[model samples]
Target: MYDFNFHKPATLDAALETFESSDDGQFMAGGQTMIPVMKQRLAMPSDVIDLGAIDDLNGISAGNGLVSIGAMTPHAAVAASGTVQDAIPALAELAGRIGDPHVRNRGTIGGSIANSDPAADYPAAVLGLKAIVRTNRREVAADDFFTDLFETALDEGELIIAVDFPIADAAAYEKFENPASRFALVGVMVCRTGSDVRVAVTGAGPCAFRVTEMEQALAANFNPEALKGISIGADDLNSDIHASAEYRAHLVGVMAGRAVGRMA
Candidate 1:
């Protein structure tokens, strides 16, 4: 890894102040993506500010028709929380299915979403549930937060505080994951609340996005059969050695169907 100064601030204000003072600073949350990149000399920030010591950025609460997860809370905490399990079983299930035990214990939801990896699981859930991402400065709707591959709407030095997910009437997620990495080759999240339906897809595109046709069809008839002829074109999707864009496009429908079926 490149030589860099490290700071573990106990409070958000201190963290922000440190970042502002550095010539080039990067926040480290769980260090899942950041550390690996640094080791490869892919990233060389002047300073690394760790968010782990901030007490305010850790916790999970469920109530008032919402599941509020603190930014620094690990994946294992979300997967094991009785509150998450009861309030949104699909969400808990999704968290449980993330990369193995070590990654789960070390990876933070804030880092996952903030990194905005196209194949990451949390972005699908966030977009599917239409959750609100709360940063130190402002609240961003999930629809507007993810911009593109490994990118987000966050401003420079902005810190995500928490994510608030509304409890949907019904929800489910299905993913065709790469066996080795457990990263989604193709993943879909289906959520229905009242008369609204949302179908979000990950892994196939530059970023997690909604399938308007599937959403419209499901809103009219929430069933697998309703998605009969629905399919997204492969022109805009990712094509890697793991899976072709055409295959990912096909899996999008299959996964969406399976997710909707699971919600039944």
Candidate 2:
């Protein structure tokens, strides 16, 4: 990795102050993606502000019909949390399936959602569960948080504090993972809360997106058969060596069906 000043701030105020002072500063939360890119010279920030030391940004809380996950909370913690398993088992399952043990232990929820990797798993859960992303300044609904590829609604230097996921009445996640990397080639999350039904897909598009057609169909009948004829177009999806756009679109339907089946 290129030479850069590193700061491990113990408080949010200190982290913000250090970021403000640097010409170009990048926040490090678990360093799963950040470190890999930096070593390859993809991201060479003047300063690396490690957020791990900030105690307030880590932990998991569940109550009041919501599960609040601190930004720095690692995937492994979410996977192993008894509270998460009891409240939202599907979410726990999704977290457990992300990468291998090393990635799970090192990747943070905030960093994953902040980086917004098109194939990342958390985005699917965030969008499908209608979660609220609480940042340092304000709360952003899931629909408005993810803008595009590797992009978010977060303002520059605005840190994500936590993500609040409302407990879904029923939910499940299924993904066609790339065997080597374990990244979703096509992942789908289906959830129903009260009368609202949502279907969010990742790994197939530029970013995680809701499938309104599937949602509408599933809302009418919350079953695998409800999605019999529903399909998403491939025009805007990613077409990589791992999978073609059309194949991913096909897997979207298959995965969505599987997820609904799991819920049933």
Candidate 3:
């Protein structure tokens, strides 16, 4: 790894100050993506501000009809939370299926969403649930937060404080995962609450995005039958050695159907 100064601030304000005071700095939540990149000499920030010491950035709570998850809370914690299971079992299930056990223990939800990896699981849930991303300076709706592949709306020195997800009436997630890495080849989150229906898809494209047609169909029928002839074109999907864009496009519909089929 490149030589760099490290700071573990006890509070968010201190961390922000320390990071901004440096010529170049990056926030470290769980260090899942940043650490690996640094080790490869792909990133050489002047300072690394660790958010782990900030007491307020880790926990889970429910209030005002939403589940608030602290930015620094690890995936394992989310997967095991009874509150998450009771309020949104689909969210917890998605957390449990991210990567492997070791990755889950070290990866944080804030870090994942902030990095905005297209194949990452959190974005699908965030967009599907229409969650609000609470940052240091502002609140960004999930629809506007993820701008593109490996990118987000978070500004320079901006840090995610927490994410608030509304509890849907019924929801489910299904992923077609790469066996070795467990990253989604194509994942779908289907949710229905009152008159609102949402279908968020990931892994097939450059970023996680909602399928409005699928949402409308599901809103009308709210079942696998609703998606009988629906399919997204492969023209804009990611084609990697793991799977062709055509295959990924096909999996999107399959996964969405499965997710809706699994809803209780």
Candidate 4:
């Protein structure tokens, strides 16, 4: 962890201005990922522009069968939001299951997805539900937002303003978690949002991905039974000390079935 200049601008313009002025500046959203990385000396930015004080970055609104959440809105706020619970209980449950209470209290949706942690919960929800990622300059579709491991489609200076999630006809998330850390060993989010069925998987690959075959099966018949005998080859999936690629590949099917079962 290196010493760095800290800036908490009250406006988006001010934050962007401060961020652009520095050669090595980074945005601090909730500081959940940045703080830990800083402590471990993994990141040494010259300036840290805090987005917390920007009022526009901290609220939740729901309308027209879609729920919009501010970038800086905390995970706890999202989990406890009455509007969220009613509009998308599965999303609320997913938010509640993120890390522990402290992490949820401080970690944010924007920060989580921006970091693009391969095993993160929000990416599944974002992609599975086909959300719109509104940024300072443009809107990115969820399908295009996650580009690779720890990567996104956002430009270096772009800041996410908010995310718009379209309500689904049915949705559920299931994860085989590492008990100690609670990070997903393999997580799956199953959703049928109108005519399309989407199955987004996380923790078993470099980044969360969709299984279109399963999506098609589930789309044809919205039931866990529809997923029977389907498989995802392990060639590109993750193989780690926690779980082997084969095991992870297996868990993907199991979790997807469980997710669909909940919604079935």
Candidate 5:
């Protein structure tokens, strides 16, 4: 890593102040992606503001038919939380399956959402579940939160406070993971709340996106067979060494089918 000033602010206000004071300052959440980028000299921030000491950014609560997860809450905590498991077992399962034990223990939900990795699992869940992202300044719906690959609606010096996920009638997440990184090659989240059916797919495109056709089919008939003839176009999908765009598109259908099957 290049030389930089590191500041561990004990309060959120202090962190925000430090972040705003410098144009080249960046927030350090779990240091998962940011650290790697720094080591590769991809980012050379003048100041690194560590949010680890901010006590207000860690907690999990369930009430009013909604589950609120703090930005700083670790994936392991989210996976193991009684409230999360009781309210949304599939979400908990998804969290549990993220990366390895160490990654789960260190990576934060806010970090994941902010990074907005094209193949990240949480984006699918957020979009499918219709969760609201709470930031220091405002609340952004899941649809508006993600902009594009490695990008979000978050502005400079703005920090995510928490995420509010409303409980759904039935939901599940299924992903075809890369063996090495455990990142999804194609992940799908299916949610049925009342009469509304939402289908979100990740790892198959530039960003997590809703499958309107699949959602319409599921709304009519919530069954794995509903996705039998449906196929995703491969033109916009990520094509890497591990998998081709066509393969990822194929997995989108397969994973969506599995998710619907699991829900059923």
Candidate 6:
């Protein structure tokens, strides 16, 4: 890694101030992706602001028909939280299954969302649950939060405080993961919130996005059979060495079916 100033601020204000003052400063959350990129010299920032010391950025709380998860909260905490499990077992399960034990222990929800990896698991849950991302400046809806591959609505010096997930009537996530990395090749999260059905897909496109057509079909008939005739074109999907765009599209449909099946 290149020579850079490292600051571990005890407060959010201090962190933000340090970040704002530095040129090309980066926040270090879990260090899962950021550290690797730094090592490869893919990203070289003048300073690194660590959020680990901030006490407010950790924990899971659920009440008032919603679950609020701290931004810096580890995936393991979300996976193991009794409150999260009780209120949204599917989400808890998804967290448990992300990456592996090591990654889950080190990765933070905020980092995952902020990085906005197309194949990351959290985006599916965030979009499906219609969560609200609370930042140091303002709250951004999940729908408006993710912009594109490795992009988010978070402005410079804006730190995510937490994510608020509204409790849904029923929800489930199914993913086709790459064996070695456990990253989703194509993941689908299905949520039935009251009269509305939401289907969010990740790993198959440039970013996590809601499938309006699938949601409309599910709204009319909340059954796996309802999606049988629906076809997801491969043009908009991602194609990589592991799988073709068409294969990813196929996995999207299969995962969607499994997700809906789990809701039964």
Clashing pairs in 5: none
The TM-scores, one per candidate, come to 0.99, 0.98, 0.98, 0.98, 0.98, 0.98
lDDT tens digits, residue span 135-248, model 5: 999999999988999999999888999999999999999999988878998999999998799999989888899999999999999999999999889998899888999999
Q: Give lDDT per model, in order.
A: 0.95, 0.94, 0.93, 0.92, 0.93, 0.94
Model 4 lDDT tens row, 1-264: 567899999999999999889989999998988998999888889999999899999999999989999999999999999999999899999999999999999999999999999888899999999999999999999999998899999999899999999999989999999888778989999988777899999898888899999999988898888989899999998888899999999999999999988888
What's the candidate order when arranged by decreasing lDDT?
1, 2, 6, 5, 3, 4
TM-score attained by model 6:
0.98
- RMSD per candidate (Å) reads 0.7, 0.8, 0.8, 1.0, 0.8, 0.8
Tell me the tens digit of each residue's lDDT in model 3 across 180-204: 9899999999888898999998898
Worst 10 residues of 5 by lDDT: 14-23
Scored by lDDT, model 3 comes in at 0.93
Candidate 2 Cα lDDT to native: 0.94
Model 2: per-residue lDDT, tens digit, 1-264? 678999999999999999999999989999999998999999999999999999899999999999999999999999999999999998999999999999999999999999999999999999999999999899999999999999999999999999999999999999999898799999999999887999999999999999998898888898899999877788999998998999999999999999989887
In model 3, which runs have C-alpha deviations exceeding 4 angstroms? Answer: none
Compared with the true structure, the alpha-carbon lDDT of candidate 6 equals: 0.94
Error (Å) of candidate 4 at residue 95 is 0.3
As a whole number from 0 to 100, the lDDT of residue 36 in candidate 3 is 91
Q: After aligning candidate 4 to the native by TM-score, how far in Å is the CA of 157 from where it should be?
A: 1.1
- CA deviation > 4 Å runs, candidate 4: none
